[model samples]
Target: MEGNHSAHGAFILLGFSDRPHLERILFVVLLTLVGNTTIILVSRLDPHLHTPMYFFLTHLSFLDLSFTTSSIPQLLYNLAGHDKTISYAGCAVQLCLSLGLGGVECLLLAVMAYDRFVAVCKPLHYMVIMHPQLCLGLVSLAWGCGVANSLIMSPMTLWLPRCGHRKVDHFLCEMPALIRLACVNTAVVEGIAFILAVGIVLSPLAFILVSYGYIVRAVLSIQSSSGRHKVFNTCGSHLTVVSLFYGNIIYMYMQPGASASQDQGKLLTLFYNIVTPLLNPLIYTLRNKEVKGALRRLIWGNLHLRKTI
Candidate 1:
């Protein structure tokens, strides 16, 4: 009974099911999104999408799938009245995958920005430069880079001693949450995480910014107003997506820990970790007419098939 009590005190997350009714609603909402994104990505790969833009878009969909899969299924199980807290092993797995996907996503966006620059400025060489093999290499590199980063941080993080209370206030097992639970002094671990976090974000961000600057100059060189408008529109969409991701990330990581001043850290984390990925497919589809048209055609064709059947 005493052992049982201790386990409950360290209870694997019950997740956010305290509200009961919200569980069903969130479940439907998130599941629908997951399904929609899967369909969209599958459609994007239908040979018609050999271009760099759609290639990156599909990668984004894949990232969103990974991001949600890393956390949501467990969260749903918790909502459905399963174990609330994750086992130590499960938390470690989740942390690695989640952080890896997140870090890779940061880099992938930078790659997309560079792809855009090539598409706009060096249209003649765009195909030759971003050939099938190189594009594959870039995408593969993004995944490799992300996992490498997590490999560095996750073990560094999980090795800390959890000698005290281990209840993570948030639904997901964040690095900060796990670090805070450690009974040992976490200053060193936190410092390492901080350095790694910046490493993950800053280099990719610098690349992205430089790529966009060149892209803007290239866009400006287009003497035709119509050509300028089209280029600007495409860049605008990419810019918006970049801003949404980085805004939340910079907000979350920019804190140098003195901000223990409030409970707002959890709220800020939600913006990037939970909320941003949920809305990513929507942002991409809405901004890119090609994606929107493809989705509409897909929906229409599916409906036509259902009627025929």
Candidate 2:
């Protein structure tokens, strides 16, 4: 069945358009975008930091970069202007990309946890176990699964009988908000969404928990306090990231948007999309000595080269 809405149909993203203060949200989005970009560059430029862990972090940075970029700019535009309309095609694209990147991040976080697990549980074998080919394969698999999920979910959600109800009650074209606009009974679609949410969110979360369970066991076996501390620092940033990402996600999708008011949901989505990406670099660079050292060397090395010039 063809969508009654034309391709040119527009959605009014009620994104902070209701709020008197919009500058702060714009500032936060731009700042976080820059921070995520910097993490990607720093991870790439520092040769000493080129390990499986940092490799995953680089992938993560890139995911956050693309993920936030997919929606935040449009969101900022809506926040800044009285004209908050998003073209139907634009909304579709936003939904697809955001969902894909978000799924990738969720799965990739679990993969990172496994990377930490192997590093801590099998130190001597870490290099051999997490080889270049395996790392590439894992990252590729993550991207593939993410894209596949978006392919499935986005089209179905967009094709829903919206009956021209086009005002999306959030800053972005998120799945839940779009779903809420459907005019027809959306039980099956919502059910599928719930299942996909479980697969994308909970499964990865469970894997992370299991990986950390093994990690904790291994850390407990270490007699040296310094050894334990070193291991803890390595995993802490990732653990924090997982907690933030999954916690909001699980709550948001727990029962088909029953958990929060539209306003509250927007704030939660804001945290996940904006605040989390901003904090990711800060968390890793601050808590992990290796990233900090690499960043410092990169900064000083640039300065020294400039002096020569």
Candidate 3:
């Protein structure tokens, strides 16, 4: 629209900032925020991180990194560069990573819920069952599912016809947005995507609910009120996270097709997509006394070593 009216084939992702001053400020702030999170999470990798809970937490941190990376960097580039247009290939990558990681997080959250359930309900058998090999496989499968989904959905969504306007309202490509943009009859895409998501998300969520149901049952079986209180306190943080994640996603997706308000759509997208990933590590780690203790000891050890030397 500016200098090259008919030169570029790609569409610009104007992103969060149109004002120059606001864009620079937000860029600095967001970069600092994400950078701090990455620094803290990666620095925590030690023998202390060998526990099943920490193992999963590390993977969650990694997913969060990838999730933000998929969307944020491109937005930054668009904000700084004169040409805001993204190539078809770059757009495809955005769609893949966004959905892939979104799906991965859903599965991983269920796994974490199950982990908590076992720790609370079946403490006696926790170590024997949630062993290293099984944990590794689940994390590996999480990554694998995301990668495979990228391969399938990216092409499936992008390869569709582009008869009308090619502009995407979102800062990054999302399924609903891309599907709306597609020229093909989306019946098959809708059905296949629905079934695929239901199997991955709902099935695991059902398993998590069952796990927590048993967990609650176990808690109720406690004779002492104090014992019940302790168990409830231990699981409360995780329950809140699961509730928020699913609640936002369900509200966004399960709406009546007739009521597709764009403002509400963007708000809901921000809630689960941007906010939840940021909160995961902070919530889970703060809730766990072990991780806190490990962090404190790690700091103290470094301080003591410096003094000794």
Candidate 4:
């Protein structure tokens, strides 16, 4: 075990160093952190935002925040200066957190899709169907599944014998990049990883699609055009978020092995980790009138309280 740990004590994250300008752009991760934090705070503070949708959204924001934080700071540090080396332990933690949080987001998004489906298709029974207990259970299950996935995959990936190769082609300690470092053939491990990826990534995506199918039908059945428009408006933000998240995830994880281009993989990972989290808050806040109104109320109330003081 000591030999294994010492074999590759540290990894050099060769992230976009060739394109120095791109590193400057990645500082936007700070905005991603603030945006997700605001979503969580606003959702908790505002009574009007206390609904099933926002309940799930708060968790989602937390997952995005965690997912981005797991690796971005090190990545930014690597980009900013000469020291790009990360300890083996740091890489392991990053891998576990990123994998677990990512899995949680995938499942949480599907849960959100189900929440939307209930609200749209069973409007009268929405509360009864998606009660607080069920919401909690769903979230707990997502979290549990994600943690299990990380426990299973992180150890397996890190355990692979690197045989002295310590340079990770990508920014973070992602599974694919680490797998490439192994001295032995990784076909069996990759197979297991692929199966797990399908369960974590593809299954939730399929469930989201099915939920949205029912939602679309229910929206179309509305007799009034205005009614239909309202329903679509409520769902559009979630749909956009799902597209952005899942598309990049699928491209990154689904194709495991040498066939995937390292350059393309790095770029996709950057977009997925950095841009997706940043856009999530903008998508939810800008397109969601309920959230916008809640923000306005929260801000005004804060200002009014200060004036009274």
Error of 4 at 189 (Å): 1.0
| Of 3 and 4, the candidate ranking higher by lDDT | 4
Between candidates 3 and 4, the TM-score winner: 4
Query: Which tens-of-lDDT digit does each residue in 1-31 have in candidate 1?
Result: 4433332244355344454554554454475
lDDT tens string, model 2, 190-282?
Answer: 788789988988899899999999999999999999999998888888899988888887877765543457877788888888889889988
Model 3 spans > 4 angstroms off: 1-9, 14-46, 224-226, 252-259
lDDT of each: 0.71, 0.84, 0.68, 0.89
lDDT of 3 by residue, 139-200 (tens): 88877876776677667777666564467666666666666655557777666666666766
- lDDT sort, best first: 4, 2, 1, 3
User: Distance from true position, residue 254, model 4, in Å?
Assistant: 1.2
> Over 4 Å off in model 4, which ranges?
1-8
In candidate 2, list every pair of residues with a backbone clash.
none
Candidate 1 regions exceeding 4 Å error are: 1-25, 28-32, 35-45, 254-262, 300-309
* Predicted model with the maximum TM-score: 4
Estimated TM-score per prediction? 0.84, 0.95, 0.84, 0.96
What tens-digit string does per-residue lDDT give for candidate 4 at 1-309?
A: 654875559998888878888888888888999999999999999999999999999998988888788888888778767999999889999989988988888999999999999999999999999999999999999999999999998888888888778899988988888888888888888888889889999999999999999988888789999888788887999999999989888887787666678998888888888899999999999888888999999999999999999
Clash pairs for candidate 3:
none
Q: Cα RMSDs of all predictions?
A: 3.8, 1.8, 4.3, 1.5
Which is better, 1 or 2, measured by lDDT? 2
